[model samples]
Target: MPTERRIGPARERDRLADAREDERAHAVIRNVRAARMVAGRADSAEECSLLLEMLGLEPAAERR
Candidate 1:
């Protein structure tokens, strides 16, 4: 009976973690789509690169 009780909460934690992961994945997809739209509207190569960096779609250069 005691072992059964512990198992229930463990299962619940796993389920909650899965739900949170799903939510995070969806958010990343939305951000990528928005970044792509902004990139499309960008006027020049430099402007598009800056916009993508701002949206975190591209990694910024390291400062010396």
Candidate 2:
């Protein structure tokens, strides 16, 4: 005989919430890094612009 696994409503909600939180956290990190690059954290505006272009995002003429 095969056994069936079940998830209660509360547990299901918790799992969904955790997944969403993970996605949000990742987005926050990416946005912060992008902002830093745009603000000239590591390299010049031209270099960052080139990087952004390569990633298919618009190149900014100057740092943010």
Candidate 3:
């Protein structure tokens, strides 16, 4: 059998990072919310390219 690797984001869209009762759990949850907020703000591929450039990443190659 050949080993395989995932090429994109994980299938589990949401997950908890800590025990439900842990005080730090709120911070973890907040980080997820912040990520979603940024993802929601990008309305187009061009916007995503700009965001990546701001983060100092090269724009991904165009897909066929």
Full-model lDDT for every candidate: 0.79, 0.73, 0.58
TM-score of every model?
Answer: 0.63, 0.56, 0.34
Where does model 2 exceed 4 Å of error? 41-64
Angstrom error at residue 58, model 2: 17
Better of 2 and 3 by lDDT: 2
Cand. 3 Cα-lDDT: 0.58
Instruction: Summarize candidate 1's per-residue lDDT along 19-54 as a digit string, tens digits.
Output: 999999998888778877876799987998888887
Point to the candidate with the largest lDDT. Answer: 1
Question: Which residue pairs in candidate 1 collide?
Answer: none
Q: Which candidate is the best by TM-score?
A: 1
Q: Output the lDDT of residue 56, model 1.
A: 70
User: Model 1 compared with the native: what TM-score?
Assistant: 0.63
> What is the full ranking by TM-score, best candidate first?
1, 2, 3
Cα shift from native, residue 51, model 3 (Å): 6.0
Clashing pairs in 3: none
Over 4 Å off in model 1, which ranges?
1-7, 59-64
